[model samples]
Target: MFNPSQFHETVQRINTKVPDVQHKASQIDIASVKLANEWFIPEPVARLIIWLKDELIKLVEELMNMMTQVMEGIEAPITMWEDAYKWETVRGIATSVAADVNPSSLGSTGQWTGDAATAYTNAIGPQSTAAAQLATIADSTASSLRSCAEAGLAFYIAVALVVAQFIAAEITAAAGDASVVAAPAGLAAGLAAAATAVGVFVGLVAAIGTLIGTEASQVSTLHGLAVDSTAFPSGRWPVATNI
Candidate 1:
């Protein structure tokens, strides 16, 4: 079940983290640029220093790009909060209404007879069915939203790994000649990590799409029921025919 309180708490937690993440990314980007600009290389080592500096700066830029994607993922749940609440509220109302109109709730009209009793029985059945259908719609919508929120959080975690790789590349660049031999290996590791994260994020996005489609189909069914119910004078549905 999607608990609204839990969702709100998660959003609040992410809200507190946004500024810190952005600040760290910005600082790294600026520092990398400064190091690239100020490093002095003698003629003998100029080629190596220039190449390393350019590579470091490039890695820093990619770090910022990864940070951007992570931040977007973090923000997704906050934006979705409204929609989640809407569905949750609908679910609560529908469930309550369904219970109210159910046979057990309405009870038997054993003491009554004629058109009045017949009408009550017929109306209760269809009304209960329609209310149950509405509840199902809400449940489906909530489930889809839950999947999306979970996926977005997972995506952020995955991309953060990619960002860490760039940071490692920057550290290796700053280590100077003693670590120069390790630079290629560090860069390769960073690229490999990025590929893995992007692949996972793509898969998560596709799964979210499928969940949304299912939610839409459930909602469409409820809409159809509402339209069909319009024919009855009582305006209740799945129609009274089942009665």
Candidate 2:
């Protein structure tokens, strides 16, 4: 007998998980923007970076819902099957978005894994043409993510350089002023500006790195859920395998 209390608890847990996921996703977008502004990335590229981060976060949420269905054992095989279908649907959308961003790297290997990979492979069959197609899409998405990160870094560096130049000019101008004392004020101001630029640059870089790590972890979690949700030898059975 499925305990209603248990089901409620599970739902609550999922709810809790979602906000954390959303927070991280938002952080990724903010970081991307900061980095882009620093590096002077074009408006279009910055917007695209935000879009990619949001989309990935959305996909993760969908995957989590599907996983919950599998855990709840709502209707045994049929419900479980539906859950798998939903996962595939979300993946399809992700892949489509990735293809739109970068097609050449479509289906490149080693970028995604776990539930997404398994669901995709199962949907198209491991050796089928469809699987190959999905692989390409996954590869493209990963590559696009990497490209976005690089663009962010470049933007940050460019801004830092500009700020540094401005500070240098200010210092030189102050040096020629008769009223300007040889005290440490000018030097201190210059140092402060440079320090601020370095701090911003480092923060952006860290954010990009964190986003990548989070994505990888989420992929792994999804995969593990997909694998553990069903009983293998029984062939896609979702009756709480342990019971």
Candidate 3:
């Protein structure tokens, strides 16, 4: 009875200091966490990994964007080819040439316009098909390349520098990961270049195809305008017959 109350007061006094102790402990925990962050690599390498990770992610995104552009580019030449197929000026020229040759034979000559239109459509089909196939290939392959880059970026964080053995293994893994990224990076770039070249080639083919269609129509026009050899003994007919 003499010291029970005294002991109780002492316990309460100790309890008052517990908050301070806890605060100190919390600070220590924070420091430990920071230390853990540098567990496997030195500060420079740690920083480099973060930078490389960000850069690799960016590269992957860039390649994806380029693939989208390449696919869209393929459609442009195809659209041009379609528009050229419907172009009416050449058809009109064919009509005029037909009527000029002989109004009586205009119906027969009109078939030339149909023939040229058919030829123009035929020319565009193969080129457009090829461009579309290339676009599809680029889309699929670039997607694969981006996957490699993403996989490499996954290893960018060097975990717990505190364990030397763990760090060694992680570093090795990171090196392999980096190589994975490097390999696909090259493939994506090459594919972009190839897609660009194919796009240009498609455009050239479309233009040339249109020209060929026009030339074929012109030749048909000349044939229409010519008097048939069968109609004249001299193998030529006069421009006009007796009214």
Write the number of the candidate with greater lDDT, choosing between 1 and 2: 1
- Candidate 1 lDDT tens digits, 83-172: 767888998998898898787676566666898788877667666777777777677777666666655555445444444444443444
Model 3, 1-243: lDDT tens digits are: 113343334334433433332343233334323432556546654454444334433433443343344334333333333343343334444344434433243364345458554554444333333333333333433333333322222211110111122223223323333343332233234234334433443454455446545544554444433333333224342223222
- Please provide the root mean square deviation of candidate 1 (C-alpha atoms, Å): 5.9
Question: What clash count goes with each model?
Answer: 0, 9, 5
Residue pairs in clash, model 3 = 39-160, 39-161, 39-162, 40-160, 40-161
Arranged by TM-score with the best first, the candidates are 1, 2, 3
Question: In what order do the candidates fall by lDDT, top score first?
Answer: 1, 2, 3
lDDT score, residue 239, model 1?
50
- lDDT: which is higher, 2 or 3? 2
Residues 11-32, candidate 2, lDDT per residue (tens digit)?
Answer: 4554454345445434444554
Backbone clashes, candidate 1: 0
The TM-score measured for candidate 1 stands at 0.60
Lowest summed lDDT across 10 adjacent residues in model 1 is found at: 175-184
Global local distance difference test of model 3: 0.36
> Each prediction's TM-score against the native?
0.60, 0.30, 0.26
lDDT of 3 at 14: 33
